[model samples]
Target chain A: ARPRVGYFYSGKKPGQDISETMNNMKVGDFQSIPVVVREDVSVYDAISQMFLDDVGTLFVVDKKSFLTGVLSRKDLLRTSLGNQDLSTIPVHIIMTRMPNVTFCFKNEPLIQAAHRLINQQIDALPVVIEQPEGLKVIGRLTKTNITRAFLSLSESHEL
Target chain B: ARPRVGYFYSGKKPGQDISETMNNMKVGDFQSIPVVVREDVSVYDAISQMFLDDVGTLFVVDKKSFLTGVLSRKDLLRTSLGNQDLSTIPVHIIMTRMPNVTFCFKNEPLIQAAHRLINQQIDALPVVIEQPEGLKVIGRLTKTNITRAFLSLSESHEL
Candidate 1:
């Protein structure tokens, strides 16, 4: 299913304003270049991508690099545990499809992205940009990125 | 480095209250039983334990079952990428040690525990209780657990 652009949240408390500090901070500032994959790739190749990229998650894209699905270590580990041949199994079979995947825009506030990551219980959020074709994968906001932000804030504040 | 219990956080933009909905929630209500492991276990055994347990993380414990360290796919994957022997390596060498690990008491607000997970870039938070010996891990709050909670809320709200 193609994921709708609607944001999935009710906020920590409904009345809460997006923190001024977070709203000022955008995803582009902290996001890392995403390790993209094609839906046709075998699961074995996806695992290799993870190893080579040193990332726990991968964003599956079409030939256009349009967002299609997402894959994580748990997804690979769970599927690989059985007797099935990873080489024969295509990524689309196990990948979490669009609309089901959580994503953020590059200009969006960091708090919104963090909310999705924590509330949705996903490891990373694919930073996507809208195009005539569809939502195309760009960068990614991961927990590690957020942790680095927190550490930077801590270090700067202590000064 | 040992992390203190101090809540190092600012308000959600100002006039916000800890989501009245989330502040009322407890980890005991949402946590899953943790897959436990021993410190002396070989890396290979730990990986096998992960397969058998069907979990991305394993709680490394001692004979007393008191919590000692935590292991996840990233840890194993990173270590195994090396040419060194996995069968000979002990789990204790790679696990995130206590006092350094972020944990949550069953009675703590789920929101607070979630903050630690996102801020620390960790995949799971051990739901623990304090004993004379140390903190004993009783259950675990994972991103999947949080996703379940969000889904439940979404489904109910829709109905």
Candidate 2:
């Protein structure tokens, strides 16, 4: 098929304008599978889960499987510096608890989520669904995801 | 100044094409200050430095100040899980050493460096200056920087 290029309006254009294309990019299109752990799980186990999943951030959930908190590698590392026993300490004691966790919705524009990442200085955000009980994590969005989106933008328009 | 838009090329346009603008974003324009630790520094001290600097990755250098290795919080956290004393273990023993390290030059297109970060599955890369002896650590390129660039693109064109 010939590359989609429009004269002025869409008379059957192949590609959207750059701004239009970028603005249309949504978090759901690029989010990754979220790895979650229950609030009572040991910090030691949480760290293990992090490595196994190879994610920088992990979402913490309650017994109802609703969002409760968030854990980062930095958080775990800081706790490790203490002389406390990691296995005996539950992640809830160390996690950045709910009402403090930054989040995004799957339908949110990628640019808005990217701004949250930069301004908040965070590694990842749980892409969540609003539940009667609490937020249910449906996906993970990170700088990595934004970076991928940025690359895709350039790739799509490349000759 | 009115927003520059051209019908084709040259003439009296103000804004260049999206592809041209994206391609022109160089690593040097977006890289962050690199934080380095001597290879011989204790893992304990390195972790402290990471918290102090608030950076995800730390570059390792030799006495001569050339890049030798790189450390991520994951590396340090893994070491912490060990029974051994962190202060006794040197960062050199745990760092991802040279030759295996992925890097980018200052003049490299941001897209190229973003690819290296994703392909290598790393949080950051040392923006380096090559020398006869080894690579000189100059700046740090990370997903965060890429995310910022992505946001900037949207902000620049927003009405």
Give RMSD to native, each candidate: 9.8, 5.5
Task: List model 1 lDDT by residue over A1-159, tens digit each.
Answer: 342333334333224232333356678998999999999999888988898887889999998789999999878766654546778989999999987999999888775677688777678999988888789888988876765554333233331
Candidate 1 per-residue lDDT over residues B99-147, each given as its tens digit: 7878888888665666677767678888888899987889998766654
- Runs with alpha carbons beyond 4 Å of true place in candidate 2: A1-16, B1-15
DockQ of each candidate's interface versus the true one?
Answer: 0.17, 0.34
On DockQ, the candidate that comes out on top is 2
Instruction: Looking at model 2, give its docking quality level.
Output: acceptable
Lowest summed lDDT window (length 10), candidate 1 chain B = B3-12
Question: Residues A10-116, candidate 2, lDDT per residue (tens digit)?
Answer: 22213335666778999999999999999999989999999899888999999889999999999999999986888999999999998999999999999888888
Lowest summed lDDT across 10 adjacent residues in model 2 chain A is found at A6-15
TM-score of each: 0.60, 0.91
Best by TM-score: 2
